[model samples]
Target: MPRSKRVTIADIARLAGVSPGAVSFALNGRPGVSEETRQRILAIADQHEWRPSSTARALVGSRAGVVGFAVNRPARTLGTEAFFTDLIAGVQSSLAQHRIGLQLVVVPDIGEEVDTYRRWRRSNQVDGVLMLDPRVDDPRPALLRSLALPGIVLGGSPSGPDDSATIWLDDAQAAHTVFDYLVGLGHRHIVYLSGPAEFEHVRLRSEVLAGLAERGVTGETIITDYSPTEVATTMRTLLSRQDRPTAIVFDNDVMAIAGLRVSQEMGVAVPTQLSLASFDDSVVTGLMHPSITCLTRDTFGFGEKAAEYLLDVIASEERLPDRTGPRPHLTVRESTAPPPA
Candidate 1:
């Protein structure tokens, strides 16, 4: 005999003598159904094993109750990094309270990540999105502003290009704090190893360090693609020079970890021969034989704030938070020290 047609909510509704709407309410655990009817419809759906489908969405213009979280992080960083793990956890915290779930997508690179957001909205894959790694003059805010779609940006500015209410972190302060912390540690010659040029946060960091360098301090800017072998190769070349940098600040902890390995391989003792710091304070840093010195912004906190802000925007489009004030603070660790005398 041929296999039975794939079960649908309508099938369950027919079997239970209930409306499709009632079936949906029961399946989704919505409040419209009475307890007794809810149990009966759920029992029938369980027997048939009915699941949601976009085809049903066309039948009724409503939500699939799934939200998109589209982030643009380097492929190397995403795989070697644990910062996102905590960030995702923070979002899950808020979502669990509402019984909602996230659909995560990490694109090949920043450009593809932005493009995916546009497609997700057009295809109706999600009701809204959580965008991270905003850049200066990013096109996404403007694109999303014109569409009926709603989302929260997880960076330094605008939740929506037209509106400012989505929660955003203070990147400038985070940058400045990291720079000053290095200077305070007596790092006279410093090199800032950053991620892609398109990332606004890294750009902000470069700009901040440039201003400091203008005052006759040693600050060099080198934005490199993150890779263990690449980072090691770069450090090998940089450290071989007679006038090598005394300290290096990386944009992410994973790269800093590479820097640490490079220093060890070159017989350059950390703190004694090289000092390092990085952003994205992951547990890997602490687990290192010597924990990393980093610009410790609360990624978990940022995630929690971004999720709530997105939910608020979805509820009602609101203004973005102010960017003129203090930014995320810096928490120093063991990875940094003054140049060896």
Candidate 2:
């Protein structure tokens, strides 16, 4: 004969000739069921090899056993960017220790990201969330609070006192390091090839560049979507000018490589004529022909810390204070040198 179907409380109740409530009480070791009924229910449950369902556990205010990470970036960009991959790996490493899972999603804009959070909460799909790339007036923090969701805002400063804990890096100090290094190298005319202007880090870096004007440095800003095609087009325009900048700093390594390729095509010798640097570092930065100079940080460690914080908040049901995260340090390579005399 074939094995019997797996038994639920209802099935066990029918087989034992008792009500479902009585079976539930017996199975759970609650008081209402007699010793005789409890023994029979246990035998039937064991015979059917019944196990608790995770979904059922969630509906009863128990953990869903997973956390969420939703990023508001173009899907194509995430495919090319190494920053997120490293960060996510760190998060997974920490989560693995606690036998937790991560659910990552990519959305086109903030609106969709907010909707995702709502859906996750309604279905009890995630225990908490991890937010990234905070904007100047970001609403996600408040939204997370409104939904009673525990979250950590990574790579950004706290927007409000009552908002979720923020894991912030000092963008201003990092930008100053790059700017002062270029100035020390005798590059008076510099250009900042930036990412979207709405990003708080981009705004902070631009502010740092603007302050250089007092020191008699000519700093210009050009914003892009961090796409190679747009970066190359902008690079071509910059290199075509007679008064081209002596050095250009990019927001990411991919953009730096795009600009470097454009410079080579335009017959501009790197370091000898124009110096190139980037804010984010990856293996490609070091493997490039001249090796782009960049800011290096432990992105993986950052992800791990974010995961740790969110999990702690979820477990304790308490709000944690904002924290300062690691800042990127300058890594000089062959791409940067004294401006052409």
Candidate 3:
């Protein structure tokens, strides 16, 4: 079959028997065109694979066609964590569909992250931003709002400004799931190895563990940098104690894997002597010895949804409601079992 000419809005209007203005209104999702006419115009546009050129979009005030994501984490830690890698792939995948690019930056700390956002806004380097690792009393939301820049927060509520929308998982419920599973396995002494304490999700998970005190199940939390070295040291330190926990939960798959290695070096057997579980499920967790039990969610899909929301916010002046992404489900594998007799 002969290929169709590069479809244009005028071609869509001519096919749908509507004015070009009507086609524009319908395609942009603005009011003015009747719903019936809007549907017809959309159908014609879809049939022809019509997409506006970046030049056309720029005439309508579109910026550099780029989005920003800044992370305040050490390069070593970021390099090892599969979650960031998978999440970035997903975000890029979604943005690429619309010809939008991502401007990712790694900063040394929160202060640097704030400065990066400021620079991006002032220089018009990015049309919008995607925020992660939300903290209690976070400054990013307010900073973005003050700059009048569009942004979407991932993994928690917007504490600083309502100008930004949020795409979050039910972290509290996920924490409960992990705790409940461990308790059911007859583990009383448990420990949670958490990422940075400032992260809202980490705090939420910590709260869930603390709440289990009423059930005669005690819990302790050790904050780490989510690096292999920190995780290994933390695991070794905890395991060397006389009252070492019979079960341990880690924040991410990398730390869980590191902890597993520490267990081997210290001559501690998994599942038999110590039950291990991690928060984020990844391929490494599944392939590792004793297959780590974990709370599994589509981190890649999470990134995609977050990027989609940010794009919508950037395109429209309307306020979108905060959305909850898919909940994390617990997947049991060989890493967790009942406490040793």
lDDT of 3 by residue, 216-267 (tens): 9889998988778998989889999998999999999988999999999999
Q: What lDDT does each candidate get? A: 0.73, 0.85, 0.85
Q: How far is candidate 3 from the true structure (C-alpha RMSD, Å)?
A: 14.8
TM values, all candidates: 0.76, 0.82, 0.80
Each prediction's number of clashing residue pairs:
4, 0, 0
Model 3, poorest ten-residue lDDT window? 155-164
Taking all chains together, the TM-score of candidate 2 against the true structure is: 0.82
Candidate 1: the clashing residue pairs are 164-319, 164-320, 165-319, 165-320
User: For candidate 2, lDDT tens digit of each residue in 1-341?
Assistant: 13555457787788889998997776655799889887787677656655455566656768878999998888887767789889999999999999999999999988889877865764467889999887888888888877777888886455467767878888889899999999999999999999999888899899899899998999999999999999999999999998999999999989999999999999999989999999999998899999999989889988888888888888875566777767679999999999988
Candidate 1 — which residues are off by over 4 angstroms? 1-61, 74-79, 157-166, 317-328
Please give the range of 10 consecutive residues that has the lowest summed lDDT in model 1: 318-327
Q: At residue 320, give the lDDT of candidate 2.
A: 69
